[model samples]
Target: MDTDEQQAYRQLALSGATPMEIAQVAHLHGLGAIEIIRLLRSIFTLEFIEAKELATQAVYGMSLSDYQEKYLLPLFQEFEREGATAQDELLQSGDDRHL
Candidate 1:
């Protein structure tokens, strides 16, 4: 049930007309200005979404906390139960026994 206005708007849009151009075409075809603006708004929204997806794909990395959790947290936890002095003494004793 597409009307003449809808067909005119679609043809103008598919030809990549600028917003002003589309409005002019709509005016010549006896459509309201608001109707042309509404169609342009939906097209802009779709383009924005597509550009955002491409940007996300182009760059990827972990946040600082993610890096710390993966690499630093385990090492810290292992030595955390033993105070610094105790850990150093244990290492020194092990070295002496090895010698």
Candidate 2:
């Protein structure tokens, strides 16, 4: 993905946009559904890893398992659910545009 596009996605996520909204904006910018999903996953994974690293380096360091259980797991699950919804929405929108 282009750095500018990735940054735009990150900004949208930070601003609390839903996955469908992010996907819509990405589509408008010429990204297909797969590219949008890949970009979103990449952004989310990078942020998750960064947060884990920070937590590990803190004075009160959190163990990997504890961090995963308390934070990563739940967030990942939520992401999966949102991602599926976004994919469906993107596909439907694409069909509508073609028709």
Candidate 3:
């Protein structure tokens, strides 16, 4: 999305418009059908993720970053380390098709 499109989308979203409503408004704002769909999907996905994070923070009584640092960051780091190890093994074995 360009600057104008981004501003319009942000304005519409902040005004509490739903994805479909945003798409409609964006279409009327001269965005193409594909562009509207892509923009709406991107915005919806971001909003959904943010909402989930907020819910987690509310439930845990901690900031999202704090909660993630305490609970999720280690697991993610471990997964990354394991993934790297697995990739290294695959490369060493010359079986890197998956990689």
Candidate 4:
């Protein structure tokens, strides 16, 4: 990293800035925003992004998991409750009406 970037990131960490926050600043300041966020979060989380590519990925859309414990599973459970059988979920959505 350049001297300026190193200094800025150190300050960001010391200030207890979040990944999302640092990301916004980097964008406003025309710095590599996404990289900053990824680096910061990776320091504290399991996520990772190469330092050089971090900035671009931050501005780009995030790839979300189709499976989430909170929403996806719960919603599926509710669907099960609503007569969405495991067998049914195994099939296409519109197949139920035909069945």
Give each prediction's root-mean-square deviation over alpha carbons.
17.1, 17.9, 11.2, 9.5
- Give per-model TM-scores: 0.32, 0.42, 0.43, 0.37
Task: Give the TM-score comparing model 3 with the true structure, all chains together.
Answer: 0.43
Candidate 1 ranges beyond 4 A from true positions? 1-8, 46-99
Off by over 4 Å in 2: 45-99
Tell me the tens digit of each residue's lDDT in model 2 across 1-99: 778878988898899975556656766677654565576566565455443443343322455577678888999999999988887887877764522
lDDT, residue 34, model 1: 46
Kindly list the per-residue Cα lDDT of model 3 for residues 27-77, writing each as its tens digit.
567666556656765666746545444444434556668888998999999
Ranking by lDDT: 3, 2, 4, 1
Per-residue accuracy of model 4 over 16-81 as CA lDDT, tens digit each: 976565665666666555456555554445355433234444454342242245457888889878
- Alpha carbon lDDT at 99, candidate 2: 25
Q: After superposition, how far is residue 58 of candidate 2 from its true place, in Å?
A: 39
Model 4 spans with C-alpha error above 4 angstroms: 32-46, 49-99
lDDT of each: 0.52, 0.64, 0.69, 0.56
Local lDDT at 12 for model 3: 80
TM-score of 4: 0.37
Flag the better candidate by lDDT, 1 or 4: 4
